[model samples]
Target: MPFLRNAWYVAAWSSDVSQTEPLQRTLLGESIVLYRDSLGRPVALANRCPHRFAPMDGGRVRGDALECPYHGLRFDRTGRCVHNPHGDGRIPAAARVASYEVEERYGAVWIWMGEPERVAVTPLPAFDYLDPQENETSTGYLLTRANFQLSADNLLDLSHFQFLHPDTLGSNQMASGTMTFDEVGETVWSRRVCRGEQLQEFVANAYGVPPGMAVDRWLNVRWDVPGLMSIEVGVAPSGIPREFGRMSYSGHFLTPETETSTHYFFAFGLPKAMGEAARTLVEYAVDGLMTPFKEEDLPMLEAQQCALGDQDFWQARPVLLSIDGAAIRARRIMDRKIATEQLEQQARIEQCEAEQGGKTPMPELTAVPIDCSALAR
Candidate 1:
């Protein structure tokens, strides 16, 4: 998939993995099986069994080890095949699958898909509001039949909300709102402000504001590399301070399952409704936000993917609109990062060949940190 492998990608929600059962998921075109050990600590490993290539997740969990479904070969959390059922109980040294580094944070399980040593250096993208003890969060997952980057573009350019989610999230004011975009390092920031406009029906309902109230609305989208977006949408009385407004945060985290498939993890947060029922608040927001995504955005993106086929988005030559500024910047940032990595890999291979006196060694990829200090804000 040529993904940014050295970054942390969301594998699943924290609640999705179980101690007694295994959950299998594909990320960055690799099959990953996630399960909690006997100690209830989350673990991620390659889903394919080393011997028969059977799915490990299809098997049962024996204490902390996962048994292969086809055979009784058991693999522990470190991906070592500990128990060999047949043939004198002799386990081959090669009978081990790759184990990925995983961390449970921000209500999500993040997996590092690259060099194990580099995992600790690349910090997880922070979302302080996702803490369960202090904030109420309801997570929703969608397996979209479109490239993950397309979903990133869809969220970065919120101008589509005016048309794509007209009944729920969109408004004419949003389309005509004054927008400004800026790029710092690998992160993009976009802000849109609309003044003296009637709030959208769903927005008013979600915030418990009067329907007919004239309000000033602000939408800010912060996009980090490899597709993690945090959006702040707020509205207050016309001509009032925006800080006094009711604010809600929506997280759009995209993990590539394949070139044409994506694992979408989304969460809706309302600060005003923190004391209210979590299910009620989440259901209300999901009905308003996710409904349109399922009905409208999915079809559009899927059709676009079909039309493009195997062609890259830039190669397909999509016409740029004014609203695409932030998305375009993000695309360019990713392209640059990928290109840089490739160049470094080639350089490493050449150096290895030179040092080995004309014999080429397998290239070792060194993780380069994408400057994203501005993204966390």
Candidate 2:
């Protein structure tokens, strides 16, 4: 599975990277080291040192630079080697590592893994609800030994909740809900609304609803490019407006670590306007909601991966279902974007080669763009 490289991927929670120690993580199959500079800004660089190809994470931070453990070579935030403790103290021009564009926002450190020039045009997806100052938030991470798309598919289709998370997050009414799919700009949305259903105990407690009370429940998920999703779940008294009821918003950001593994970064947040009581509910939401995901979803996704084993998802010939519409739409959107990017990259390479008097001339690429206007909302 070719990844969409020209995009922002969450490398880690802002709290995960520190000024004292380098945090190493694999994103899009590349080893990256993240740390804060002396001025308290995050920096991301290739984890391997050019000299001897040693891992740079083993080194210690010295001011705004990282001192290589294998040798005393020091690299600054821009990935340029500032000092070479070896003979003559003359730093080789090729001693530096690749410096990645990084931005800290929405409580996470986002890294751009594609062309540095493209970073100016590409904007990070806004996740304002995750701001800690305005919302009571809880974050959790889990490494899944499954393809990132598979995990994303699980979220796009909520029907599985009825069977996979019966006790914690699902109910019989959920499967019978009316589902609708649409597109808003570049975002794909999947919405399920279950009316006149008995509130599950876990949900009732989170929303402070009376147990067993029949309410209108909604599960709305919006997906952006490169596996970023925001899920809005709420329940309200029958025939009542949703704003008058309790709602919780959660962000599910998935970054592929490899073809067969993913880095799942998820966070739950509730408006502080819901009062101090909402803070307590946010804690319960984390513990109560994460139970099914950690115990049930994780195992199922991993087992599914083991079953597929190096085979492409479509090659496995999955049976089609109405519930799979949203996931399939997203998969197609991703496919088109990746294909377009690859073509553009090839065109650039060929143009460069042609400039150098290569035999092959640069071919004009007529890539097909994704048309979502028909489904636009």
Candidate 3:
């Protein structure tokens, strides 16, 4: 899969990894294992052990070290082999595994599957709603069998809501409203404003009004490169200012597991002032949003993937739609970024060759393929 290698991708929720339980997941086609160390700091490493290529997640955590289940070899958070129960306690020079830079913030564990130097300066997408003081949010995770970009495309284009989520999120306003698309730097956003229209029943409930009430509503969605989208939705009495209305920020964070799968993390957040009653309503709203996703979206996306077979997305030349502007912009941004990275990597390789008198230097290995059948024997 051609992915943005220099970007931060979510590995798992902070609550998903623990000192006792290790999380095994694939990111950008790399197998990653995550767990909190003895000191409660999250650690991400290549899931395979060097000795016999056993899965590190099959082992147990002892102190800050991960012990291999195959032969009891142990490795620490830095991916250095710390203990070897055999061979006179002498560890092999090449016994270490790969370790990824990890950051635990915004209620998720983010893994930098890129160059370590880039990880320090790479800014993560702001999820202010996940902050404890500003708002309360209900989060859910969905594992889907579709490329991450497909999910992003689904999100950036809201026109499909009329048909896909007819009962909960769709309305005549979404179909008839004038939509505007804009791109600023690496961000692409789309806005739709409807005046004096009957809001969707789900939106009306969240707005603390009757289901059929006519109101002014705004649906503003922003898309950042790679996989971050934030949607702001608000509704109020016609001609009333937004400050006096009910609003929510719905966040979507998509992380690619492979070319064919994704880890989708979503949050529906409302202000703290909403109180307990509003919280209950938000829960209902979340369920309402999830229904179309699980029942309608997932199956459709899976079928789309099946139809594509092994063909790349752009290779298929998808039919352009009026609502696809934002999604297309996002795809272009990502494509340019990926192309730039490929050029940079080739330059580094050429530079290494020049420095070494036209000989290719030994590249650092991030992972090794082992024959599981041999290990079984």
The prediction achieving the highest lDDT against the true structure is: 2
Judging by TM-score, tell me the better candidate of 1 and 2.
2
How far residue 373's Cα lies from its native spot in candidate 2, in Å, is: 42
Question: For every model shown, what is its TM-score relative to the native structure?
Answer: 0.91, 0.93, 0.91
Sort order, lDDT high to low: 2, 1, 3
**Residue-level lDDT tens digits of model 2 in 1-377:** 67888889999999999999999999988899999999999999999999999999999999899988999899998999999987899998978998888998888999988777778998877788898888878888999999999999999999898899888777888899999999776688999998887766887777778977788988999999889999999889888998887778889999999999999999887788879876787678777867788899999999999999999989999998999988998888888898988888676655556555554433433222222231121
Model 2: how far residue 180 lies from native, Å: 0.5
- Candidate 1, 154-264: lDDT as tens digits: 888888878888877777887899999999877799989988877677788776679788889899999997899998888889998988987777788999999999999
- Determine which window of 10 residues in candidate 3 has minimal summed lDDT: 367-376
- Residue 65, candidate 2: Cα error in Å is 1.0
lDDT of model 3 at residue 170? 77
| CA displacement after TM-score superposition, residue 73 of candidate 2 (Å) | 0.7
The sequence of per-residue lDDT tens digits that candidate 3 reaches over residues 167-252 is 77777767777789999999999888877777677667777878667788888889886898899888888899978987777878
Clashing pairs in 1: none
